[model samples]
Target: MATGVMTPDERAFRGDLRKAPFMLGELEGRWKLESLEWPNALIDVTARDGLPYRLRFDLTNYPAAPPTARLWSRVENAALAPGLFPRSITGSGRVKDVFRTDWMNGTALYLPCDRTALAGHESWLQQMPSKRWQPSVGITHYLELVHELLNCPDYAPPAGA
Candidate 1:
């Protein structure tokens, strides 16, 4: 049932999962944990306007460096409209398109932009408690912040704001 030999990071990830089992729940209209691959976890959520999306959390160096979140699934016109969705932030604090569409499949993982005119902003990821992350913060807290960002319009900065 387990995949190959577990790395120390994987073991830590499992321990974190155990400490926050509720993070995996499907509580009707809420984000649900889909799959977990050691330092990466996938979550499914429906945007406020009813668009479905997948969120990937990369937990490598977690608790030290905040997890990097990437949006997944096809982008809807509404989702791409200026202030509708989250955007990705560069390491230098600049905003960048979340997906590199030109890359080959699997090689390039990003939100689909067929219908969107603007890239969504990633206020939540950028504002994550990176400087404040501690062993006690855990994934549950991180995900709760994500839920707030997606469902609570006021939580995310208006695109370009």
Candidate 2:
């Protein structure tokens, strides 16, 4: 046996989620993560923590690096409404796939592992204090860089063969 984690079903599920069309686009660039106001609809749930809200995006198609973002609830620091705020995680990996809870009622957030070391990073984030859970703004200047790299209009052919 290989002797490792992940069963057949779990593996299949992971594959399916990764290939899912939920996260479209070769989204690569610097992104800013802004937290949305908690919807008033959750007031009836009677939870001991603040409502969750977040936004997510991909930041790999850019030039700088890979990045990701998330927003969590106040109580126990759970991702009540997390967004896939993509940026750069080159040292880690890139954002391959993302899945969030139902609009604002769920707490579970899922993102598929790409070339980025997201699983490890996420585990590290879990140990962080709740107060650190603040909105973020990721500016991927790489987009401009990419444009320059791909579509530099001032180009000339070589002098000779």
Candidate 3:
């Protein structure tokens, strides 16, 4: 475990991790947690198709404030053909376009992990059957949700699809 002074919530979260070793093992098998801060955890998980991906979880206000998940990867945009000179020299000019050229490197998606009303803005963790999060729900439930999300067709796009 990472050593440092922990807040009440952080302590609770750690307790959850300890209480559910099996669940933790499942997550570890899939998304290996690399590091853990009081409010942040860095994890590397293999996509269903075996593509490795990194995820950053912001658990600062956890429970009350859903952890924010960001896809941290430098995937080359397949939409752009190889050797095709980018129309925008600085890459900034392509910001208006639907397909981002700079997506070849840096963050790709800002997952909405909250229960927002906006379409496509809802998170699997905050969706049906799993949306009933309570104070008692611990890291196990969250990890299970992550597992489901990684396997769900609607949540996780088919590899290279």
Candidate 4:
């Protein structure tokens, strides 16, 4: 359903959707917006393994506050269960802390780009400045990071997921 008139955040989001990176991702079938309802946008991202993970982005406050993402469970129509979350960012049995299921009760990513995760991780601002969120970079910045992680050579999908 239409999410009413486009607010500033929605406008900015649509602008990012028009950007080359997002456009190319759509063309390549890498990232696809599955749904949009005001503060919530569900995006399906394809992993290198040819599987897809649906992420729900909470865009409330948006640019002023970095949007947070959670792995979505189509079956449950809720957040993906922690036990079923992706196991590792690499295939060598090492889990990347950013996508750890234990963080935020498995509700969000642990990256500095995430609003919730960045709360106690302010040091990332200087430690990983480039990865940190800046309003000017837009939502694609978040999606791009996720895309990169899921497509990296080390990414390992959860068994039977």
Candidate 5:
């Protein structure tokens, strides 16, 4: 959905998917650190399935009104230190900009975090509002909503749905 049309409340409630287990996949490999762009971050892509590669202009963030998550992927079998994932730029607070994902550079999936309330709703509510729940679900929500949006049987918009 366009950022302008989807109310913050609607955006919050759009996805209802459940969280999947963190997949430790082919992304595990040596990747280089690049740079950070405001909407997009930068990281060097070392290997997709063990070949040299990199994506300079391609990175993604969450779709929430105020996105909170940095990019993340899983790396396996590579020799780095322990406690490294959290310490990596893609992990916790080391720097807001520089980061890396655990996954290598094959099929890249950028997922967003739920940090802001539904767009059109107030930050807080006194009673359970009659409008769409506008509640926050995690990445799963985005996944579910993406599926729904893709296979929408009825092209009708949510009617106070």
Candidate 6:
């Protein structure tokens, strides 16, 4: 935990991760939580390519609101360049749609679980109810989706890489 004033959301999010799902994954070496500082949680996801990439999750309202997750550049200490985003996939158009460069200036992944993308996409809740984020869902609901996306067979390294 960072030495700062943590809000209710941060406290809740931290507590959620300490539970079984996140802890089991961490213990199993599926992913490593690098650091958590309130709204930002930088995690290193081990990809199918045997390389690791970091994601910085913006957890503003947290459980009440979906997170805005972005690929992170640890060196730059900023969002990864748009060109380096994992916006390509070979297997399914549905998956490709979620990893796009056309929405929100490509700041966040275009998943129904993302805060910014989920705003006007309320229809996703009814159409693909399972994909929608709800207050009852934990951070694992979103992180697991990201893990799938990164490990999917069709996933490829970014063009810049």
C-alpha RMSD of each candidate structure in angstroms: 9.9, 21.0, 9.5, 2.4, 19.1, 2.5
Ranking by lDDT: 4, 6, 1, 3, 5, 2
- Candidate 1 lDDT by residue in tens digits, 35-154: 887677876665454555566677776554446555653344111233434434322111223333232322222322111211242443355335233456566554554454455533
- lDDT for model 1 comes to 0.48
lDDT of each: 0.48, 0.27, 0.46, 0.81, 0.29, 0.77
The predicted structure with the larger lDDT, 1 or 3, is: 1
For residues 1-161, what per-residue lDDT tens digits would candidate 3 score against the true structure? 54676777777766766665535654567656666766876665554555444555666656665554444433441222322211223333321121122443322222233322113544444555344344466444545545554544433332243
Query: Candidate 6 — what's its lDDT?
Result: 0.77
Task: For each candidate, give its TM-score against the true structure.
Answer: 0.51, 0.19, 0.53, 0.89, 0.22, 0.86
- Model 5 over residues 28-129: C-alpha lDDT tens digits? 333333444434333333321232222322212333343323233334322322223222122233221122243332122222222322333343233433
Q: Candidate 1: misplaced stretches above 4 Å?
A: 1-4, 74-131, 153-161
User: Model 4 off-target regions past 4 Å?
Assistant: 1-4, 89-95
Q: Worst ten-residue run, lDDT, model 5?
A: 17-26
Candidate closest to the true structure, highest TM-score: 4
What is the Cα-based lDDT of residue 91 in candidate 4? 36
Distance from true location, Cα of 86 in model 1, Å = 5.4
- List the candidate 3 regions with Cα displacement exceeding 4 Å: 1-3, 21-24, 74-129, 153-161
Give the residue spans of candidate 5 off by over 4 A. 1-117, 123-137, 155-161
**Deviation from truth (RMSD, Å), model 1:** 9.9
What is the Cα root-mean-square deviation between model 4 and the actual structure? 2.4
For model 4 the TM-score comes to 0.89
